[model samples]
Target: MELADRVESLTPSTTLAITSKAKALKEDGHDVIGLGAGEPDFNTPEYILDAAKNAMDQGLTKYTPSGGLPELKDAIIDKFKRDQSLVFNRNEIIVTIGAKHALFTLFQVLLNRGDEVIVPVPYWVSYPEQIKLAEGQPVYVKGSEDNNFKITPEQLEESITDQTKAIIINSPSNPTGVLYTKDELEALGEIAIKHNLWIVSDEIYEKLIYGNDNHQSIAEISEELKNHTIIINGVSKSHSMTGWRIGYAAGNETIIKAMTNLASHSTSNPTSISQHAAIAAYTNSEEEIERMKEAFEERLNKLYDWMMEIPNLSCVKPQGAFYLFPNVSKIVNQSPFDSVDEWVKQLLEEEKVAIVPGSGFGSEDNVRLSYATSLDQLEEAAKRIKKFVEKYSV
Candidate 1:
């Protein structure tokens, strides 16, 4: 059977591939420690679960507006106002199946064929694929590891061309948990405005930040920037509601209306019960959220230390998010392994540790190990990884 041309060019996700191998190993009765998950280890909070149950009991099972329920939109608006001090009206919001869907919808509405979107290296694996799926081109600018895997405004400016339509900024980024500061955002906002480009800010990991760092939305830099920015976020990471699939996009009314129209014909609406649960997620006290964050911070600190102890593996200390992106190039160079991908596969096969290789995230020198597992599992994974590197040391 012939597939569409769009499907032909799509690169399968390396994250999922490694994870599948890990699961297969476990099924074979091998005690595999998988560190490739991109979600909170914790289950959804009791309050949010109760909200969904109540909604179902009340027969809230019908379709909602393609955008979202008005109340859910209001809760999202309140969250922005309270958290980022940015305000939005209901017209500017569209709820989708997930943040990934929100991004997919944004690219579909904003891009024409041959349009270009600037994507930073070590990006969340989906960004480039989604842009391609929209028939848009993804022009990547590599971020320096010394800069904590963040691209500078100068690099962003250099990537822009006549066909450029938008740029993606995923702070507290996936794969690499680097957060952009207020100043960093202000500088990048200037570049976006100078080039008259849309800014797609994916803040899915906003609430997962650790220590003194805070998540700053690029939209909040100024009112004008806000107009140019579409904020994509969800309860999945923030409230440990990954399965709920409630995500939203907020931006210019016209673009949002267009996305909503597209969604109406596509998904029609996000799940009604999930929207209700999301409302509870946003409205309830953030005690459970804080508890989850604390656990991740603890895991990150210990696991990062353990990983550094492994010869030739060095990583940037992540400010937010749950993954540690360690540069394994030195070890890969010294060891018998020819590539980070090979090292990843061998480690999984021999030491029973599974981690996503960095080639999927556009950097061949690093590999992403998620600390979103239990402390015991993470500690064991680190030990196994260290042993594997030592065994292969040339």
Candidate 2:
């Protein structure tokens, strides 16, 4: 069977691949503790579920307009104004199947062959593959653990070239869970303005932040930058609605229109029921969100402290998101295995704990462990990970 040449250049999402492998082991009767999956463990809040049920009862199952339902788009506009202190017109927003779909559409509309997108290393696994699928080149700007896994404005400035079309800024980042501060964003925004680069701000995990740190969207900095930025967000991480398959983007009218046109042909509008439910998600009080955030913070602190207790298994304290990306290079070089992948494989085989190898996220010396499961599962998984690390220590 001949697949499209574009398909040949893309790699499967490493995070999802790890989740699938963990599920397979669980089905095989292993007492596997998976720290690889990235969704919150909490059930969708009752109010949100009720909204979906109500929408169905109201016969909102029919297809919505290609862009999205007006009510939903209005809700999104209000959300931006209320939460981020940013404003957008209804036409500036387009709901898609998920944040992933929004991103794919953005790439298709903006990228031409050989255009380069500057992505920081240890990025979400899908960014590079999606860029490649759009026939664009992904130029990685490596961020080290010493700097808390964040790319600096200096790095961004150095990475720009004639072929450079855009840069992706994933705050409260996916693999590392680090959030970029307002000043940091402003510096990058200046660079983008100078060089005419589109800032694709992936803020899907914006509401899942921990501690006193706030998630700052690049668009919130100024209207000029906001005009040039495409903000991708959704109900997946924030509302525990990953399966609902709804996400949206807000940006300049031209880009949003292009994305909507592409979406019209590909997936059409997002599921009508989900769009209605999303209206409730965006407009409702955030009490449920705050509760979930507190729970994630508690679990995240526990995981961080546990990882710290294990000698030679140091990790940066993630300010946001439900993940802890630890630099395990010490263990990698000392292990009997030849690579990070082999070490993770052996860890799973021996300890029945699942984690994503760092190599999968463009780093060879680290691994990502998600704490989005229950506290009990997190505790058990941490214990197993500690024991496994102890066995290999000199």
Worst 10 residues of 1 by lDDT: 379-388
lDDT per residue as tens, model 1, 1-394: 9999999999999988998888988999999998899988899999999999999999999999999999999999999999999999999999999999999999999999999999999899999999999999999999999888889999998899999999999999988999999999999999999999999999999999999988899999899999899999999999988998999999999999999999999998999999999999999899999999999999999999999899888899999989999999999999888899999999999999999999999999999989999999998898888889989999
Local distance difference test, each candidate = 0.94, 0.90
Question: Largest lDDT belongs to which candidate?
Answer: 1
User: Candidate 2 lDDT, tens digit per residue, 100-128?
Assistant: 99999999999999999999988999999
TM agreement with the true structure for every prediction: 0.99, 0.98
Clashes of each: 0, 0
**Model 2 regions lying over 4 Å from their true place:** none
Model 1 residue 110 distance off true place after TM-score fit, in angstroms: 0.4
Reference-based TM-score, model 1? 0.99
Cα RMSD to the true fold for all candidates: 0.7, 1.0
lDDT of 1 at 269: 96
